[model samples]
Target: MSTYLPVSGWCYMTNDLMKEIIRVAVEAGERIMKIYEGDIRIEHKEDSSPLTEADRRSHEHIVSELKKITPEIPVLSEESADISWQKRKSWGKYWLVDPLDGTKEFIKKNGEFTVNIALIKENALAAGVVVIPAQKLIYRADINNGAFRRNYDGAETKLTADNNLNTDNLKIVGSRSHQSELMQTFVSNFENYEIVAAGSSLKFCLLAEGKADVYPRFGPTSEWDTAAGQCVLECAGGVVLDNAGNKLQYNTKDSVLNPYFIGMREYNEAVLSWFKALN
Candidate 1:
């Protein structure tokens, strides 16, 4: 892989490479849409999560294309077989992919599902691409460069999160399909707030585009599910922090399950207090 130094002094992915990553994710979304329009046969994995042909097809296509794009870098997908920690612990960087996020939304035909792909460098997000196939919206970001969103018609716009946001009337984004008691409690603490129920990584995209102020996730999610979105949100002047107010990291342990996290344009003392209380 080639290295490029940005003004941030971070040797990260270049704009051209990020563009290629977005292309791969968009292509995978095209594959997913094909199966989504069909009978939509579903299966269950060992964990009992719903699985569909779209997930498998998208995973295969993403892994193959990423390998061809950078054969030196390893790729990990939600559908891939578990690799031993002994082998993966030493990996400095890799591709983390969730071919089909929001399977529940897909099954419900709500057009909230998405395709996610991220590049992880030493457990930190280096670059990411999130494609909402149903919404015809695409988002991509890298650590050094800023974030951007592209429409289906080929028009692209730069994304900038609102750092100087008003916390009085918070626009909170939550899951449309998945909900939890903890999440309910977190929201209840806020006297003045509006909730936007969305599915998939669109929660993060909402924050990146300044449409939403905060997103608190208390349920289970894999690294692949959040890594891509984290990159986009953070690059857009936002942050995704764990309960401890620390930024989320990937591939530091054997398990892929991620800790509870809050996605926000900027850290709010009131919001962090609520998250800390829950923890």
Candidate 2:
């Protein structure tokens, strides 16, 4: 297999490097599982969200491996101490990571959490990988390169987002942790939709693979929460657009919080029209 991919106007990343990222993600997942399967201790951050040993182990392992792989590229991880915007704004290319994306799901043992890693080039997502630790599934993609899914059995399949607009039975994915009345009201616009409650970046992965049609997140999400999954989904022909129908961009502002957005396999005119009316 070739190690190099030509990405004009951006630093090229080798296939070997991508594979190493996948390997690192899997190893982090293993570390998370070891903590998941044992007696667990939980702590809380300033935000009052649950933090466990699994999250710390995974974060430490992933950050260490990424630094080893690309020491020149700075990393912004969920577990890392917050860097000042002045420093972050100076970075031309860097890694955005959430070592354990769904800590709530991890604590609940629902097997829905994921490890997210994204390459950000000049405020745009360049490449990404999402790892489902419990399932041993890995999804990845890069700019101009198509998306793929690797199953637990080691079989790989190219991924594509569903382009058909079937209004009769729309499948909408909603957040398991951050559900709110506003989101429910937004989802009510779909007349014949079924809500699929999901956690973390897996919602985007599901849309990328045609398992779900749309995901509307009206609640809070940081840049690291969505950047990796966005790359995979976008490469698979999906779109993650904010309420204004603009593509979700990263690192454009000092704050890492993301605006409410929808992940869609195919653009639905009716939904957008309604979304515009409401927003």
Candidate number of the best lDDT: 1
Off by over 4 Å in 1: 1-11, 177-179
Against the reference, the lDDT scores of all candidates come to 0.86, 0.85
lDDT for residue 213 in candidate 1, whole number 0-100: 95
List model 1 lDDT by residue over 110-186, tens digit each: 99998999888888998889999988889988877788998867888889995676777888897655557888888
| Runs off by more than 4 Å, candidate 2 | 1-11, 175-179
CA shift at 60, candidate 2, in angstroms? 1.1
